[model samples]
Target: MLIYTGGTFGMVYDEDGSLAPFNFSLVIEKIPELQSLDLKLTVISFPDPVDSSNVDIEHWQAMAYIIKDHYEQYDAFVILHGTDTMAYTASALSFMFRGINKPIILTGAQIPIGATRSDARENLITALEIASTKNGKVPMLNEIAVYFNYYLLKGNRSQKIRSSNFAAFESENFPYLAESGVKIVFNESFMNTHDPQQKLEFYPKMDPNVVVLKIFPGITEEVVKSILNIKGLKGVVIESYGSGNIMSWRWMEELLRDAVSRGIFLYNVSQCMGGSVVQGRYETSKMLSDIGVISGHDITTEAALAKLMHLLGTERNVDIIKQKLNVSIRGELTVV
Candidate 1:
């Protein structure tokens, strides 16, 4: 089954020349090439269009419930979504539908489907092909993934690295599952699979008591102090500099200690792409280790944020959440 969550791919020009969502029922008509493919296709769309930026816990819950309600009937699913927060939703879904054995591929276009030079048709076509891909009876891909610009990337490992280019997403910490070209190349050695016998677990919502802090040079004590002081905040994902380095100061140490003492889970991630966070490798980051900060170890900021919200939402104990964040769940981070 194919689900449309509303994006540029479903838009067309209105009578006044303004962009608007068109009837998704016309999808097969708009892209007639699907007629040649041998697959049973079903299209379902959200009642209202949602800009990816507006997606929140409720949207995630709704999406999970929708998929769960139809899980038994469909062989696989292709979700057409907006690109702006694709990584965020992908990461969240990876946690929401743990142990899901069916392929859940999320895809979107850089340009609208109605535009003269749109990239939607090829993306949608390839996504459907990948969803239907099978070795005998079991699908080749059984995890949540994002297919874009000829690359099939692990959803939690992806980040939106560009806005203007057709290649808008990349998997910096992990290799892609497959690449489309003259022939689709599957990286079999690097691919991950789900246990078909294991039951799928569903998490409908995430805890909203989380915040992300991006560290910058010369950040004032007042700024950090205010951020760490958010009312009832349980989790914080700190985007630190190279190798998770941050300013070393007594006040900063005191604040972090206070937060930990108050049972807040702290995680450190590198702002640089392809860089791993090693807590005690440098003088600046060594203090983080001393104060019990959890190392994110090469996780993207998007995944870090989602994992934090997921853990805090499902597991209440701060210590258990700290341990789980340090371990790999759904391949979001490299635990060292």
Candidate 2:
């Protein structure tokens, strides 16, 4: 099944020569190679496609519900998404569909499919190939993933690091699940393994009352206080300095402590692209740990925010949410 949620990958030139979303039902005409794959294809698109920047909880719920409703019918699923918030959606879906036994691949293009020099054709083709691949009678991939350029990255572990380059997404703290070249090479050791008896758990709810607070040098107390005090805020993903360190300012510590006291969950993730969060490795971050801030370990800021929203929406128990945050729920973070 191919789910189109609107992106550059589905765009083509209209009568006025303006870029517009083309009819995906006619995708076979655009890429006839799909016919050679010898697979039955079905396309479902959003009624009104929106840019990735505009994707919200409603869109996430729609995608999750669609997969859940069709879980028994499809062998695998492919999602065509915009590049901007692809990682966020991927991460959210990973958590929503825990213990999934089939592949759910998300791919998009940096350029429109209508352009002669576009990369959309290769991306979509490869994504479909990966989704359909199998190991004997079982699916080769059983988790949500992002296939871009030539690398297949675990959905929750991926981050969009480059805006203009073809290699836009990268898994800094994790290894690529597979790399496409002469042939797709699978890194089975790093791939997520699921229990055969584990049933898929669909979580349709995702609370958007979460905010990402990136710490910067010379940040003022007023700015920090206002963010932490946002009305109805349930969680905060703090993008801290090296090894999850923040300035050891008394005011900042008090603000964090007060936020914790007010039942706000603070999750600490490293600002660096390639490191884990060792909360107490330095004295600067020891205060955060002491204040009950959950360590995000090696999780990306995008994944951390998504996980926060998922937990806040599904679990009401604060302790359970904190426990899940410290562990890898869907391979989103590395414990060690």
Candidate 3:
């Protein structure tokens, strides 16, 4: 199954020369190589294409529902998404679909398919091949992943680090699952495998009452208070400095402590692209640990936020949510 969400990958030059989404019905005409793959193809597109920036909880739920409704029919699934929030979507889906026995590959392009120099054709083609590949009768990739610029990154581990470049996504803390060159090479040691007998579980609910607060030097108390005090806020993903350290400010500490007391889950994540959050490793971060702020370990801010929402939406117990936050529910973070 090929699912097309709005992105540069599906765009083409309109009659006036402006870029617009083209009909996927003619996708084979645009890229003739798909016919050579000799696989049954089915295309499902959003009713109205949406830019990635506009992606929200509703959009994520819709994607999850589509996969759940058709989980049995397809051997694998491919999602063409916008690069801007592709990592977030991938992360959310990874959590939503638990113990999935088949591959769910997400890919998009930096340029439109209509352009002569576009990278869309190769990205789409390779993503499909990887999704369909198997080890004997078992699927080669049993987890959600992002395939871009010749690298296949675990969905929850990926981050979009580049805006204008073809190599837009990276998995800083984890190794690539596979790499595409003359031939696709699988890094089986790093890739996730699942039991074929395990049934696929779909989590459709995701709470959006979460915010990402990135701490920086000289940030005022008012800014901190207003965010922590947001009405109905259930969770906050704090992007702290090196090793999850934040300035030892009395006001900030008091505010965080108060939020914890109010039952708002505080998750500490690292601001660095390539390191884990080691709360209490430094004196500054020791306050966070003392205040009951859960360490996010090596989870990306995108994945942290998505995981928070997923947990909050599904679990009613605060203690259970905190426990899940400290562990890797769907390989989104390292426990250590």
TM-scores for all predictions: 0.98, 0.98, 0.99
Q: Give each model's whole-structure lDDT.
A: 0.89, 0.92, 0.93
Instruction: Name the candidate that leads on lDDT.
Output: 3
For model 1, what is the error of residue 297's alpha carbon versus the real structure, in angstroms, after optimal superposition? 0.5
Location of the lowest summed lDDT over 10 successive residues in candidate 3 = 191-200
**Candidate 1 vs. true structure, TM-score:** 0.98
- Specify the poorest-scoring 10-residue window by lDDT in model 1: 187-196
TM-score (C-alpha) between model 2 and the true structure = 0.98
Q: How do the residues 205-297 of candidate 1 rate in per-residue lDDT, one tens digit apiece?
A: 688888998999888889988999999998899999999999988998999989988888889999998979999888999999999999999
Q: Which ten residues in a row have the lowest lDDT in candidate 2?
A: 187-196
Q: In angstroms, how far off is 116's CA in candidate 3? A: 0.6
Off by over 4 Å in 1: none
The lDDT ranking, best first, is 3, 2, 1
Clashing pairs in 3: none
Q: Where does candidate 2 stray beyond 4 Å?
A: none
